[model samples]
Target: YDPKRTRFRNQHRGRMKGKSYRGNRICFGRYALQVLEPAWITARQIE
Candidate 1:
């Protein structure tokens, strides 16, 4: 084991079972883009 390196635990890809009710409104910025459909957004797309 390397003490200088950080290790992350494995996680399960759980179900996204329902429509999200939280954060439906824009809290910051003058403009916000809304997602009309479900999507698999990746980290590269966000950056």
Candidate 2:
């Protein structure tokens, strides 16, 4: 049982699910950036 590989597979599956759910309006990269940017800015401000 390779946990790392399993985790990667699960994440990949989730990304695919998001793509289908959004009807391809958001690619994975853009979706991730959209999600991360706000949190990233907030973390930077706190630092």
Candidate 3:
């Protein structure tokens, strides 16, 4: 997790961005989740 007030550079954010193999959330207040790969039976996130 990161501090909401902390700033991130474009390069730093790009490096931290998640790939398709791992689940990630899209930006812009979409409130959506992305799961492109297989995961364990109980591994999940709820928001």
Which structure among the candidates has the greatest TM-score?
Answer: 1
lDDT against the true structure, per candidate, is 0.71, 0.38, 0.49
Q: Please write out the lDDT profile of model 1 over residues 1-47, one tens digit for every residue.
A: 75655576555767665555698788988997777666667999998
Counted clashes in each candidate structure: 0, 0, 0
> How well is each residue in 1-47 modelled by candidate 2, as lDDT tens digits?
65655534533322222223354355455443233222223566656
Candidate 1 lDDT at 26 equals 83
List candidate 3 segments past 4 Å from native: 1-29, 41-47
Candidate 3, 1-47: lDDT as tens digits:
76556465443422333345533546578587655654433445441
Candidate structures ordered by TM-score, highest first: 1, 3, 2
TM-scores, in order shown? 0.50, 0.14, 0.21
TM-score, cand. 3: 0.21
